[model samples]
Target: MPVVLLLDIDDVLVLPVGYKRGIPATLETFTRRLGWEIPLPTEADIEWFEAAGVTSEWDSTAICLAGLLLEAARLDERWIVPDFDEAMDRLAARALDGAQIRPDYVAWVKQAGEATRLGERPSQAALRLWQREVLPQLPRSEALAALLSALLATTHSLSCPTTAVFQTWMVGSRAYEEAYGRPAPVEVPQGLLEQDQPLLTRDGARALTAVWYEGRLAPAFYTSRPSRPPLKEPPPPLPVYSPEAELAARLVRLEDWPPVGLGRLFWLAEAVGLHENPTKPHLIHGMAAFAAAIASVDGIIEIQALQSAYETLQAGELKGPLAEWAEFPWHVVLVEDSVKGILGVFRTVRRLYELGMSVRLTVFGIAPHPGPKAEALEAYVDRLVPSVNDAIEEIVHLCREG
Candidate 1:
């Protein structure tokens, strides 16, 4: 069987510098251009929002919009609830759950989510805001689109052999579909065309099918019961005067790293690789160094409170096409750019393996940031490479060896 190279979009096939730079401005533009009276988040707020996104329970853009709404309401007496802090907490909780926000904010949040999830063209609202508020200021969207197109073409050439048996499916995050654009016939290179046979031929390779995101088909195509795993018990509090606690304290004061919630810190400390402390693994050591660079101004108590709520959030389960894909006799490669992406891929691989599937899983950690608890992942995935091209080369070598 031909190897099925599952790709990731952001930071994997395409550098995410556009996303990293454009998103904040996108959020600000939404508020200003749409007349939503939402207050702009401070740098501290942005850090908190990004940290929350690591959980994957909430879409990062949605959380950004929710934070702005809550902050705006908190500052303006006219928009304030009786219990400002409590209301803000409730909003944060809802955002993490991926619940649609109030109508005024929902359109922008939905648009942003769609851009990331489906790779759909920017919504009118997003485009208008960008043109008016962001385009003149900064131009990253065009570059992002060009990079996405090139990635799609490259993936097609690598995975879809001109003559072969078995199908090639693109299994990835919502953003993975951005290259194909909602499924029209894609033009293959002239060289590939010469060797290509009918897609349905018994001995011919199947044309690439741009379907499945996060292991499920598009929402419109299929619906399944939401997988709600039981919540894990919260980690015990750090002991006062311990080295762990001291390190946690120091992490919160750093100016460069995103503001990790105290609960996340505790979780990180107990997490397999991070728990090793002084004699830490490279990935863990890298995380500690990162945390020191961008410590938050928020106090431990405040972060702990946010962490308490975050703990209650549930992550969606992988099902449908993704699960089915695991059963196929294909070499599966997962490419991701963040610690969260690596961790999620690891969990999926473990689950598939437990189900008695013989999966040859290789993970590519593309341009992953320094911080994040990803050390244990190296053990779960068969191989970890630095880039997509490296991953593709590894896949080719593995197939030849086989």
Candidate 2:
């Protein structure tokens, strides 16, 4: 049986400097513009959020901003929370700004996220809960209601200012305009995207490459990074903004591997009304990546074919033409760093079994340090490796054993 490797990009194959720094930078920009002077989330704070399944930086930014607004609505007496548009207009015009928002808001957000179970959209769910449960108690105002609605719409809409500014920081101003068909809302000379560093060593990259070429393993990128639309036949010019996963793949010389990223999932939701986010911790993302990997092994690289495979599996239909290549006695391995991602693969394996598909899943979580992430990952992952290279070695050994 050919082993399928579902690879996570950030902190597994790469350090994700762009996303890590870009998140804080996005918060800084928002705070500076609003004169809120809110403190940036610490690395530990980010780790907690990730462990709690708030993996998307866009979501993280929204959480922080919404938290501040919630706290202000409860405590700040003088200032009234404006609707999303009025706030943005004032921010753009440099009219009036507010004072510092303390760290208590983040703590409250954490509590709320935990209570709500942080579903598919953690930020939106938490905020909506706050809006419904807590907002009603706060001297009811149209502005507060409108502000809450807009904040919830951040992940829901592509035209959101927060997402636009964050993407601009990650892809740089020029690339942002090229990709989004408009000038960046925020002025940035350079993008943080290029600052991302590869974690995979040359030898490790070579080993994976060698195994891939030998037909022993089929590897594909399974990440939450934004991607261009997955089209059967792309139009005249290929997109220049290369998906974030593509950028990470290039850093580790795995550019040719199939990628099942946020863009494809988003497109699928729009096309078939599947779901808005099937990203990690959600089994759909893993199932899609598994389909893409199976397609790749059969010399089928078009994303449309991959999508067909995914749709077949999603429907639990095993006797379809699209699923002909997928068969029994499959071995799957996931290399991930986030606890939520590992749990996602675990759920995906269970789901495969429920669908009567014979598949065995082994999860390798890369947690080098002793902390919350490592401790949490230990519960779900089969093996905890110090690095992806170590995980790769184990994978090769596992392949050889059979």
RMSD of each: 22.6, 3.2
Cα lDDT for residue 22, model 1?
Answer: 32
- For model 2, the run of ten residues with the poorest summed lDDT: 233-242
lDDT of each: 0.31, 0.71
- For candidate 2, write residues 250-367 as lDDT tens digits: 8999898877787666666666666445677666677778777777777664565556646765677653434565465678999988877777778777776776777888888888
- As a whole number from 0 to 100, the lDDT of residue 363 in candidate 1 is 64
* TM-score of model number 2: 0.89
> What is candidate 1's lDDT per residue for 1-402, written digit by digit as tens?
334343333333333232233334445434433344343444333333333222121133333443344334333323223342343344344333222223233334343433332112122224334345433433243432232222222211222111000001111212122322232122211211112111112111111121221221110100000111112443232211112212222222211222222234334444323322211111222222222211222222323322222221112332333333335454445554444344444544454455554555566654333332234335445555554455544544554453
- Tell me how many clashing residue pairs each candidate has: 9, 0
User: Highest lDDT among the candidates is held by which one?
Assistant: 2
Q: For residue 293, what is the lDDT in candidate 1?
A: 16
Question: Over all chains combined, what TM-score does candidate 1 have?
Answer: 0.34
Mark the regions of model 2 whose C-alpha exceeds 4 Å error after superposition: 75-82, 88-100, 105-109, 112-119, 232-242, 319-322
